[model samples]
Target: MLLLALLEAAGIAKLGASIGAGIAAIGAGLGIGRIGSSAMEAIARQPESTGDIRTNMIIAAGFVEGVALFAVIVCLLCLFL
Candidate 1:
């Protein structure tokens, strides 16, 4: 009985981890998309500052990706450990 309970708990943990990872990825994608869209609008308004806007957008996207990656790693760790 204890063994069965432990197996069920592990299964639940894996499911939770997968769901968390999916949420993290979706959040990151939305964040990056918004950043890109806003940057494009800003560049359209002032074409001369395109370089600066582009640079900032890339940096923001990188940060978002980094966060997403960390979340995914944590989730995977939960599944394995």
Candidate 2:
């Protein structure tokens, strides 16, 4: 009985980790999409500041991706430990 319970708990942990990783990926995608859209709009409105806008957009997107990566790693850790 105890062994069965342990297996069930491990399964549940793996499932939760997978779900969490998926959610993190989705969130990062949405965030980067929004940043890109906004940056394009800003560049269109002020063509002369294109360089600045692009740089800022890339920085923001990088930050979002980093955070998402961290979240995924944490979730994966949950599955293993």
Which lDDT values do the candidates have, in the order given?
0.92, 0.92
| Candidate number of the best TM-score | 1
Q: After superposition on all CA atoms, how large is the RMSD of candidate 2? A: 3.6
lDDT of 1 by residue, 1-81 (tens): 776458657688788889999999999999999999999999999999999999999999999999999999999987787
Tell me the tens digit of each residue's lDDT in model 2 across 1-81: 776468657697688789999999999999999999999999999999999999999999999999999999999887776
